[model samples]
Target: MNFELFIARGILSKDKNNFSRPIVRISIISISLGLAVMILSLAITTGFKDAISQKVIGFGSHIKITSFDLNKSFESSPVDMQQPFYPSLADSTGIRHIQVFATKSGLVKSEDQIQGIVMKGIWSDFDRSFFAKNIVEGDLITIDPEKRTNDILISKRIADKLEFNL
Candidate 1:
């Protein structure tokens, strides 16, 4: 059918003027509003999810290293005890920051509430200051290495669940 003939047979028809009234305008507005809301909601939700993921992935090193022997744990420990001195390990492999860390499983006891958490010991380089922007609590690593600052930086989720003040 030709374009003008098709439209004339429908809305422009003498018997069909009622079909092209306010109802059609309302339906068009409703569909446009629905689409606008859906697109806006999706954009906000995806943006928030991406921002959260970036913060988490940025807080750690790109890669890690372990030993060929003594498969005890992924806990942070002295590099000497953790790995055999391999000469080739000195190569940066394009990573910006390379540090050794150890993890120790422990239960955080705050009054009657107890939370099972892995205490990660890392060099001062990997301390909270490295993730200061994402950190929502107390001051970043200000303590000296000689004094192992038992100061642990917990995630926002954990802090809220445990009712931790900051």
Candidate 2:
């Protein structure tokens, strides 16, 4: 009744030189396939977890309080940055920080060159750590809440194509 005991006692031992039994071959193949699948699943899952973690961290914070007009469109509805929950969120536990943001997209034309670009506006409280890490060139200048700023950060690729000199 105990197959494991028989195998352990060498009573049902398999001959290594002779693999003529169909059941033995099938069992070995099945075990190998199972192990391969498990290993592959583990590897893929770990890789996915790592990639998703990096993207979530790299793209900035976990939650964004954008407008409800986000119906699969890039354009977001305008909303007042000041909200009642702002005070509660700041006072609540688990929340690291809160920042305000706005974005608009349009086409820029310069003589013969025309390019589409999206402009993102962030409040003075915005975290610049992510931007700092990704900035290929140019020192990041903080947007003074009161002062008018024309300062903009662009990707190196865009700068080169736009023939930007600074």
Candidate 3:
């Protein structure tokens, strides 16, 4: 056998009552536990990342196309929906869908309380699955392409703070 292997075998042999046996065993166990903790940490971190990403993406899509204006406000500049690339984006290799959205910064008033909020406007083509899954109390808003609805959906935290309900 090789010199290293021979020496290691001698050191690790069961019949030997050498001091190195306990040291080697402790070192092996510590290394194993450290590796296990690292693996578990990595797994937990990956799971958290995926979950948080899904939640964020649920609120909005992965990629957004907006006007290149230098406005530093919550309101985004308008992009034309009739662009030639809009229709063909779905057929592209990686893109699954595309939708238009608009946001406006406004204030909500109830009794004497007023809270500033950003309102997101969505149309019939917008995805409602995320809101549907996360709606804690009220039902999803029905969007009609022909007629406009005054219904609005707000988060539970905002509802509690503003003392509002469905």
Candidate 4:
């Protein structure tokens, strides 16, 4: 037998009760635990990234077309839906669909408290599938082309703070 093989066999023999035996067992266990932890961390990080990405895309679409103004605020400048590019965007390659939306920053006042909020306005053509999966309590709002409605949807956090519910 080779010198390395002979030495390795002597070190790993079951009859030996030397310091190296405990050290070898501990090293194997430590390596196994480290690998397990790494795998778990990777899985958790991937799931967290996917969840956060879905929430962000749910709040706003993948792409937004707005006026090229220099205004620095959460509210975006309005874009005309009658633009020539608006229709072509839906038919373009790698594009799934197009939607028109608007946002306005405002304040909501309760009997004893006032809170700032940004209101997002969507039309009938806006896709509600993303939100349908996330509605915690009530149904989605219905918009009529011939009439205006006073219905609004609020998050649970905001509802608790403003003392509002369905």
Candidate 5:
């Protein structure tokens, strides 16, 4: 039977003194609960995905430009920091800034903890306003040439894994 006809029958069954009111109440409750669960799942999934992706995008520039040849080897190579145009390509492109990056894959060693990770070294001119906005503790990592220490800013997930308070 069609859905509308089925519903009419259900209503008329009760009106005609059939003993199915309790069953109809249960069906209504089950349908409401199912819809509630589906809505809750969609809301949580959308919110969680948006929050996580925004953090990732904020930590890194929206796009990057590099010589395809230089990036092929996946090794660490420092930029000269003397030239202006190469690093300022993003500025010219109407973007905020262009940051040079070198990636190093290695194991991080602490007194009581160790972890494997890839560190992306950003150039001195790379504006860190994006990171500063998302930092949870300590301080944002500044790329000053004179103060190049071994300290690095890590994500909250890494901090949790390492048992660091940041």
Candidate 6:
């Protein structure tokens, strides 16, 4: 029994191309297929993870600065962009760039079409790269601190319903 066990282990571990038994060849083929399947699965899962993460984080940043209020919804008061802690916060480890943003609920009306929409106000400092990558239609709005732009991006569903010209 010991000899047989040693022989079986040696057969599997040998680097030679000539396999003595059909069972050993079958086992090697099975292992190769299993490894290929595992690699394919890993690649597919990683791709999906990256895509979902981009979509989720594209809407908001990892850290948010907001007012301390009981109102949990988006109706909370805005936080002052110029804060005393900004200097320390920027110097802190793991901290990167900071951008000021605001939001207000409003209705967009055009002729006979009226739609309730959440107007997101972003400054020139706001990162547009994320939106540029994930945007399905139209181009990313070029924002300038010195100048204002009329460029607006809306969803196709809204555009279709509103009968938008551009």
lDDT of 6 by residue, 1-166 (tens): 6998888777866575565667878887999999999999999999999988877777777788888989866666977767889778878888666788777777778789999887678888877777777677667887877988777777677777888765
**Top candidate by TM-score:** 4
Sliding window of 10 residues with minimal summed lDDT for model 3: 90-99
Top of the candidates by lDDT:
3
Name every residue pair that clashes in candidate 4: none
TM-score of each: 0.64, 0.64, 0.85, 0.87, 0.66, 0.65
Candidate 1 lDDT, tens digit per residue, 31-128?
99999999999999999999877766676555556546565764544457445544445564754555657778888777668888877677755635
Q: How far is candidate 4 from the true structure (C-alpha RMSD, Å)?
A: 2.9
Q: Which portions of model 4 miss their true places by more than 4 Å?
A: 1-17
In model 4, the Cα lDDT at residue 104 comes to: 90
In model 5, which regions exceed 4 Å deviation? Answer: 1-14, 66-97, 145-149, 156-166
Ranking by lDDT: 3, 4, 6, 2, 5, 1
Question: Over the stretch 71-120, how does candidate 4's per-residue lDDT look in tens digits?
Answer: 98979777877987777788889987687788999998889878899998
In model 2, the runs with Cα more than 4 Å from the true position are 1-41, 69-73, 108-113, 156-166
TM-score of model 4 relative to the true fold? 0.87
RMSD of 6: 5.4
Superior by TM-score: candidate 1 or candidate 4: 4
Better of 1 and 4 by lDDT: 4
Stronger candidate by lDDT (2 vs 6): 6
Query: Which lDDT tens digits does candidate 3 get at residues 34-120?
Result: 999999999999999999999998887889888988898889988888898877888899876678899999998898688888999
Q: How many backbone clashes does candidate 6 have?
A: 0
Candidate 3 vs 4: which has more lDDT: 3
